[model samples]
Target: MDRLIEAIEDKQNPSVVGLDPTPALVPVQVMDAYHIEADEYVEDDDDNLAATGAAAAYFEYNRAIIDAVADIVPAVKPQIAMYEALGPAGVDCYTMTCQYAREQGLYVIGDVKRGDIGSTAAAYAKHLSGFDGADVWHEDAITINPYLGSDGIEPFTAAAGETDRDLFILVRTSNPSSAQIQELELADGARVYEHVADLVEQWGADTIGRFGYARTGAVVGATHPEEGAALRARMPHTFFLVPGYGAQGGTAQSVAGMFDRDGSGAIVNSSRGIIGAWRDDPRYSETLEAQTALDLVAANARAAAEDMRDQLRVALA
Candidate 1:
């Protein structure tokens, strides 16, 4: 977490691009370049050409975007669900993407959101912690589901402690239906997410890093500014991973309070808005060849990230 914050401070940018790619979002050239052919992938359960092609395409696309934006942004978040849906081929792509990003000097946060209990929790923590054999998907930080409470989160904390990694426990997710659980009130009148926020502070206390913030952080949706501001005051020591910007309708103005008075302690994520920028960029030329088309996408991603960084600065001011 300290390292992540340092990266943010060094770049003076609190934005992270989410490398969550869908088939439609990736370029056709990428799919054609690395896709596992239909005949080569044998499992009917996971062997669809589209799925495999999408994974390969995403990896190629991720590499291009990372190449373009790595210098300005501090990190890249790869939502695991996007890769897991495609099966082993997708998993391989995810691993490859992480490795490539790390090589490019960018932090990788695996949005696994795994939750369980006891040994099960331990196993989930172990896997998500990047202990799987021949690991290539090692992450500098990860997101975990906090619904199962302390039992499910303790293993991850313990794992992080040993690995010197960081964890962002989901407190208030971005989806509209998240209120069903996160907004519930206890007998004490505290909202469910508030209680979770308090626990997150406690969990992160022992791991307080050099920046006066903890390695354990919270995922607070940027869509709810009042609650986000409230959480900001409540968990001063816990960093935040703010999502729901751009495509999710979260504005920089709404997320401003997620940061501290100095404009530190949080990172706003923009996925499709950054990766899919080529769709709207006037610089894109349909007449270009495959490699040039990929370069245009890369340039578009870089431009979008720079634009978001400036917007965030304005909102913070």
Candidate 2:
């Protein structure tokens, strides 16, 4: 787990590329190359053949993105909905994607965000912890929803203890609707999320890695920069996963406060803004394969990440 944390820290740019592949959103030429049919794509009620095709398409897209940006970024977060909707074949692709990412020296954070109780949560831990099976395991880390509070989180914590893995508790999400519940003022005047943040810090305290940061982390949305900064201050030793940076309209400057003076303790995630940029990019208009659309998007991502990192460096200086 320490090695996982250290890998991101060493990169200086703590940007995690989200591999969110939407069949309709991918470039037309790319889709045409695969000859992917709309009927074969993921639907609310996809049969096995449709599901298998969708999963295969997702696997190919993820592989291409990973090959392009793995060296530049710290980690890749594969959204579970996109994969799970495709069913078992999708699960197989998910497992392969994790394996491929590890081979490329990038951490795989399964964006499962699973929340349950007792045995079910433990089963999810086994499916995700990377220690259960040598082939299908994703060892880096998995996202956990803390809506059920300590009871929901305890099982993940216990699983981390067994596998030497880690968990990122969703304290503050980037979604706009999140404020309705997360910002509810508690009896003690602290917001509901603040209480969640406090618990995250405490749970992470016992799991501090070799570095000053702890393995337990909180998912603080970049949309709420001030609140994100407040959480950072409260849990100085905890790691942060800052989403909503790119497509969600969060600027690089807005997310600067989430990191330490050394540009550590946080990783900013962007999905549609990077991978989907090619569709709207003027430079990508000239030639799809000949030009570097993916490369350009990846470069821009690296630049955005580094720019945010440099802002912290300048602030500290």
Candidate 3:
């Protein structure tokens, strides 16, 4: 966690761009270039051609975003689903994105949310976190699901210890319907999330990092300010991957409590709000929504990152 905290302090920013690119958000020019670049790999297979082209598009868009904001932000969390949406080639895009981000000296939090038991869990624990092998998909950290209980949680923590990496356990998510499951009351008088938070604390107890926080952090959504604050008190030693900002309606004021008073324990994430800003934000209104100039596309992303940094700075101040 010292590595992660160092990046945060170096950039003076606590948020990471979620490189969750979609065709709708990507400029058509980039897509056309992708298809052309895929020509070498296409040969005779139509399906492979389409997948290759789409994968190329995603990779290029993600690379541009990375190049744009790498210096200002500590990391990039490429929501695996975005790449997984494209099938095998999509997975290739996911791994390739990881490789490129690391090359740029940025950290990565794989938004996989994987959870299982026994050997299956152990396998995921080995492959997902830590960049020990040549496989580029190895991430700096990954989000994990705690539904299967401690058995599911221990494997990832073990994996985290093997490297200076981490795992963000899903305690309370940001979605509107998260409560239906995460907020259920247990017989012990603790809410479901509170129970999960306690599990996160227990799991990370042996692995506190150089930053005085644990490698096993919690995914407590900033959307629930009160709940986020309470979880902050409960898991003082855990870091937080606070999502639901920007596109999901989370604000600086809402997520302020997700951090320690020192403002070093959380990393906020803004996905569509930053990646799709060429379309969604008024500041970039004049830019063409389709086939944007690559430089302008990246420039806008950098601006959005700076703006997010400022917002957090104001809140923390």
How does each model score on lDDT?
0.86, 0.75, 0.86
Ranking the candidates on TM-score from highest down gives 3, 1, 2
Instruction: Point to the candidate with the largest TM-score.
Output: 3
Q: Per-residue lDDT for 114-198 in model 3, tens only?
A: 9998577888887554345645465899999999989887888887887678899999999999999899999999999999899
Give the Cα error of residue 277 in candidate 3, in Å: 0.8
The sequence of per-residue lDDT tens digits that candidate 2 reaches over residues 72-156 is 6778888878777777777887888888888999988888898887677877777555443653566478899987667767778
Report clashes for each candidate as comma-separated counts. 0, 0, 1
**Each prediction's TM-score against the native?**
0.93, 0.85, 0.94
Q: TM-score: which is higher, 2 or 3?
A: 3
Q: Comparing candidate 1 with candidate 3, which one achieves the higher TM-score?
A: 3
C-alpha positional error of residue 52 in candidate 2 after TM-score superposition, expressed in Å = 2.4
Residue range with the least summed lDDT across 10 consecutive positions in model 1: 127-136
The C-alpha local distance difference test score for the whole of candidate 2 amounts to: 0.75
Better of 1 and 2 by lDDT: 1
